[model samples]
Target: MYVAVKGGERAIDNAHAWLAEERRGDLAVPELTTAQIREQMTLAVNRVMAEGSLYDPDLAALAIKQARGDLIEAIFLIRAYRTTLPRFGSSLPVDTGAMACDRRISATFKDLPGGQVLGPTFDYTHRLLDFMLAADGDVPAAPEMPVDPAPVPHVMSFLNSEGLIAQETCDGTPAPDLTRAPLELPAARALRLQALTRGDEGFVLGMAYSTQRGYARNHAFVGELRIGTVPVEMEIPELGISIEIGEITLTECETVNQFTGSKTEPAQFTRGYGLVFGQTERKAISMALVDRALRWEELGEDDQGAPAQDAEFVLYHCDNIQATGFLEHIKLPHYVDFQSELELVRKLRRDATGQGAE
Candidate 1:
């Protein structure tokens, strides 16, 4: 049982004042602005937005600033603020195929339609730390390429055309919103995807790594990975027409797994898909592998009892906010509960020793 403690109002107020002072650390140093965090710390802002399930970069940056760069805290602030906002209409599904890709690549094919375009990525860069950046030296602008007008075709489309890949079909059912309703098991693929996209990156990455390291191994290959901006559209009920709201950057990954076939059916390649906000390639790729692993039952593959294959385990623990809240609560006043436990232990010990309850 938990009990509330009183008579610490003065201490609590002092602690709050101290926290505020520490948050504004180093009076001599220039104060950081939300705009600076939004622009310079773009990746951090993106993470806050992604995990917080909000797309407002400005608000995310502000939260980051208030949280003093503690990302999970920033996410908590954003989520709390998001709860207070009024609901708006949902947007139409984004067309990633029509994305103005910043980076596009295929590992399966050497030369496919819409040739490889490596945008701003750190993949090929050496791990050496540049001292020049520390000195805040001026950097030259990177050369620009002419934008291609044609729509970029999905890499899986080629496989689909050849009847090599298992085709995905939609039943025209509206996808369930986990935000509105509590997560119910056995979740649909759409709901799983929703959870995965907003899941803690480190947790998802570790689960995905487990699959690659021979736990329910699915021989996976990245068919294509792309990052770009896609327009968001929402249909107005009064106007009865769809209008473009805005564009948001996204990273998309499609992984082709080893073929599965029955005696009567031809061997066909299976697939895993991941799409996430911003240029979070690692998170997106990890999401795909875990997604595929979780589909073991539906894909007719053996479960092998992998953690990633356990939907309840993955879905329940993937949320960092929930995990952190439970963890951090232990630091709060548990004195009454501890005292009860302490009394029980002492009584048990005394009983074992044949001592009186004096």
Candidate 2:
């Protein structure tokens, strides 16, 4: 006989109440403000904004606080909130060439225009935790250096001029939005890039690492990695002029991959591109590598049956929210299902022992 439990509604209510209390932690300790999280836990807020496809830092911080620092849950909350907002006219494509770059680096060139700017990177920092951060301490601002005012040219543009890399052709067609339509087979490059940008960071990082570990090796070189603020503009139909709407921080990565051309084409270097919201360099670079790995068919290269090479596998499994929902749903009521299997097993055992009694 199977037993069923009731009073799930009350139990759920009490659990939520307890969770709210736990979220606040000790009553004696000061409650963390949203501004504090926005400024101090900037990377977390940035990740939430990037994955959620929203750009409001304050709202992202609030979501983080409400989620108790669960980044995916914060992203989910932001996504849910975004669905309720009214739509505005789309802005013109941002001119990244005019970007006021704070961090600009090119791994392919030793020296270039605007030079290499190692701005606000954790790359050189020691992994040791600073104990001073635990206690309240007055922090002094670091001295600033004069930044190059001239626009920095893209590294890939130089290669393109020399006819050494694949040419980026523009068809002027509006890319399909995956949010509005169902995902179809043979996704376009734009759609694939959008998915990779919003996909789980850890999952994308693993896929990119797998490619580097001889699974569809593309011999990728970091052509450039730039992080900075770019002005957003919207063309006013009434005024017939474009004006700056606002500014947003972004991270862009371009990978140069070795291409041995097929019989139909000549050998040249190829490119993989990634642009993401906020200063998420790791995510952007990983996204670019994975993007290139998925382009094997378009590049006329043979698929090595690698995990990164499987577009369907990467797209389907990259969503953290969907994966979490399915995994957590196992805890739901399944007594009837297990009872059926139990009866079947008992019946089979009884039949084997020559006992036909029910």
Candidate 3:
């Protein structure tokens, strides 16, 4: 190879200029409005919000437009911006069980206490692209509707009564924030789920898929999937009562997996859990499967040395931001280390050829 060139500054400047131009197509075309993107490209906004761990739809939409529709890059941008903003205080954890659900379904039961509402899902939509979207379009606005604030009942409440699944008990310990701190080993389920929710959707999906393909096959059934805007409240010790601070969209999935009985107990069902920001069913579902697989040791199942069963394997590899940062950091500059390796190779080859000649 031609001796490496070292004009990184110039290369970066040119690349950035090209990216900027690409992001804003022809100057003639009116720039994409943020409102247009937010309303029309909602799925993209949802993914960004979910991965970025911030729920500002307008900002997410702006990030998507600036990234030129690259969802992961948009997420990265939002996350970077999110880190810079000042934090006031943490809201008391939202009681998702009490969420005013927009959509709810229970695979475990055909008739739950609250009837399942299949609201705004593409699961039944045909895969064909809509012609109306490309042309400046107007679909009739959904009717003016008044919705009552009905509480959603959990699907697992019935199972809990019978003690079929492992009981979930929280001692009310506040979960650690990974953004402000580095991840430590032997993480709790809350920390694990936090990492998975903001994790790369595709990466987590693959890890979950591997579990089902007999890698660490834990027979899992979709116990429930729910999507809705849940009210976040804070109990102001000064004020003495919890008040709703804001609301955020959430996708929650719980998977019921097969469990082996302990010596004193009969066989029972274990659990895999997933929860993420925004209406992201796929990511949430995947998180649940992988979450369940990681619980093998706790559930009295042998650690069959599967990838999903390995806590270290799943938690660390699931984040695209971390993976991409480390992967791309090498592209920045390692000339000092590379030159040392090059010299070593040259010296070894020279000595080997000289010895052969002798």
lDDT of 1 by residue, 1-358 (tens): 5566576788888889998899999999899999999999988988888889999999999999999899999999988888898897899999999999989998899898889988888999999999989999888888877989677899999999999998898999998987677889989999999999988999999999999998878679999999999999999999999999899999999999986687765899988889988988999999999999988887777879989999999999998888899999998898988998999999899998889456
Specify the highest-TM-score model's number: 1
- Residue-wise C-alpha lDDT for candidate 2, range 197-280, written one tens digit per residue: 888999999999999998988679999999999999999999999999899999999999999887878889998888999999
Candidates 1 and 3 compared by TM-score, better number: 1
Taking the tens digit of each residue's C-alpha lDDT, what string does model 3 give over 157-187?
7888898987878989988898788888899
Each candidate's number of clashing pairs is 0, 0, 0
Regions of candidate 3 where Cα sits further than 4 Å from its true position: 1-11, 140-148, 355-358
Considering summed lDDT, which 10 consecutive residues are worst modelled in model 1?
1-10
Report the backbone clash tally of model 1: 0
Clashing residue pairs in candidate 2 (N, C-alpha, C atoms within 3 angstroms): none
Candidate 2: 10-residue stretch with minimal lDDT: 1-10
Candidate 1 residue 19 Cα shift, in angstroms, is: 1.7
Candidate 2 wrong stretches, greater than 4 Å: 1-5, 356-358
Whole-model lDDT per candidate: 0.90, 0.90, 0.86
TM-score of each: 0.96, 0.95, 0.91
